[model samples]
Target: MSKQSEDLLPLWTLSTTETELPLSLTEPMTPSRLTELRAVLAALAESPIATLEAHPLSAPADTSKGISLGRMSPLAQELATLAAQSTRSVPKAAGNSGEVLYRMVVPAKVAAEVSGGVLEPMISKAVPGGVRSALVGTNGISAHASFVPATAGAAGGSAATVGVAAAGAGALTVAAPLVLLAVAAGASAHADHKRQLEIEKITALLEKLHEDRLDDERNRLDGCRSAIDKATAILLDKGKIGLSLGLDTAVHTIDTALASAQRRITDWRAALEKLPPDKVELRQLNDAIAGIESPGSEFYVHLELAELAIALKRRVIVLQAVEHAQQDDGNPFESFTNSINLDAQNLEKIVTGLRDVLLRLSTLQLDRSHGMRDFTFSSGAVDKLLNTSHRLRALGDRVEAGRSQSDVAIEMVQKVDGSIVVLPAMAAE
Candidate 1:
């Protein structure tokens, strides 16, 4: 390859490992609640005659009409989002209220400990009447009905209104009783209508919740697939470079490896079948996407670093020429002040660019094992990243410390030359 062509290749090497993190499934449930949920799920799955009680719909006072996950309480919104993602319809029965299940998606960390009818209790105090459960089945796990307390006497008032109406109607021979009977009848009917409205609202909220989660998972899966395609293109280019360099053996190996990687992408795409959005399924899809993204992200970072190295190298050449000009023919310091100023400004610009690169690296989410329980990195790549950051920091400090125009100019020249050595060595590694 020509010098220019060789320069086009990354100066720095990138490395990554295949990482798959198990999604979490542990949700905080009281021991009793977990038992009840297990029974409910078991009965629904295994028993022909198992029935679910129709709990009264009591909307939490703080809950908004539109369910916005992550806007309200983090834990509550998480639960709601999980419930939404897990929503699924079980078999429908003519006489019975057939079971409806919302698959619970928890982190893998949580799932590991939630087994054998044992729940890890994290709450110091049990919520008053705050019993929650999750039903696990072969297909997936689902959240149980969660009812929050309503306004103080809403439930009791409806029953009382009905009784009042009946009592007044029985004594209607008296004029006062007749008037009382009419008022009680109106109140009773209103209460019933209000309860029915609440039920409908809650039902709509649940449906919306399910739809939102379904859409979110679909979007995420699409994003991951797109990223994989992009990564595939990049790897193909790298393989072509190997071929151009007449590294026939290396090229053949790269082709084989890339082909396998491409097949994995296809497998991942197929795995994302339009299954019900359960925690386990969604988590698996997410991890599969991350597998591609981890390496892809690392690749781009090194690519940028290589480009920056080239630019720095050119800047160093310019600084050398400027320094030589100042030293030769007894050129006065004042005469070269303007030239020095220009170089100082340019050096500052490079510093800014390097800072941005470091920032990107810092924010990058590397491949983590077991749901980010442990962060993993390629030792070589990590060393390069840290060294680059340190050099940039030291250079920035030197630039900022320059007091006068001459100091700024001379320091900029020295730093650029020093960087040329450091960066190329990093790339060669």
Candidate 2:
């Protein structure tokens, strides 16, 4: 099956994530203060206002495009409503996990805002007392800022050292673009290599399909040989003129079916040969091969019908001969016989059945030409095609075949009186 293309997340779509925040107090935490902190955190988390944002997965949305993830389309809102009904939430930690984890639903814009600096001020204002130093963690959407109490006053030189370190980080940030460019190039090359490997795999599968078809043809030939053997055995055991006629008819039918099947296979291969390897898409090639609906499977059906019809004709001839002799009729018994007995309802039933089977065979349209018969450059394309094809063609027995009509014919012949097996006038000398 073909590989499917990845669905990239829409940058305009609103996304929500839960955040865990740690809180530190300048003084021992009072219950009232904690309550105030929780309220401020929840408000800031849910608010679309310019609260600090950070997203783990994506770059910030380009407001220039006028795409707002927060605004849902009508269809999206309906889908969200349906999804919400079925959505289940995991139980969060019971005891104090030291960090405060709160759920938030914010626009993509707020999620992309970086965490550290903007959060400290927000926490200071939200809490009763100002936060001295804070370590803010966000679900990347909402601030999960942890407030830390300010330590005893640091020596004046410490500020200077910290500023120098910040400057060094700025220098590294300037070089990030160059590093990212090199990584992108590497990724592109790897993707190309992967695609090439998939193409090679498809080529191998086509070759295997051809080989398998040849093997199937050989198997069909073997089955024909078996049918011939069974006919020979029947001729020996019964030594009836009907058996000989049935055998001959079966052989002719087998040959005809094989010829028809071969012609189809030839046509299929010819179509493929016309397609230049470079121009042919892997999917097209697979479809062409699959499009071939060979009558190879009908070989047994035709052979069985031919044999049965002939055997039944023999019985009817003998029966008529008996009736003619008893009535002292002068007409040749051969003239009265038919491929199906006229006097009995069984022949009509058998003929009707054969007609139905033939009708089915005639209507047998196979869309075997599957687009997803092999993997291609897009790995998921084949799989997607395979699934669709399966759903579309999921009915009836694919192996076109018919039951053994010869058995029914033989059974009927056995019921006839053996004493009436006298040589017909034509076979007399």
Worst 10 residues of 1 by lDDT: 420-429
Q: Can you tell me which runs of candidate 1 are displaced by over 4 Å?
A: 1-337, 344-347, 363-429
Per-model TM against the reference? 0.17, 0.18
Worst 10 residues of 2 by lDDT: 406-415
At residue 367, give the lDDT of candidate 1.
26
RMSD of each: 35.1, 37.1
lDDT agreement of model 1 with the native: 0.25
How many times do residue backbones clash in model 1?
A: 11
Q: Rate the local accuracy (lDDT) of all candidates.
A: 0.25, 0.26
Task: In model 1, state the lDDT of residue 368.
Answer: 21
What does candidate 1's lDDT look like per residue over 1-429, in tens digits?
Answer: 101111000000000111111111123333245335333433332211111111211221111111111223222332222222212211111113222211121111211211101111222232321212212223322223331101101112221111122122110011111111111121222222222343344334334444454334223222332222232222212211223333333223323433333344344344444323332322343454342223223222222222223232222222223333334333322222334345435434443444443343333333223445435656764654455444334323322221211100000000111110000000000
- Best candidate, TM-score-wise? 2
Tens-digit lDDT track of model 2 for 228-300? 4343223222222354444455445445543444454445446555655433443454455552222222333
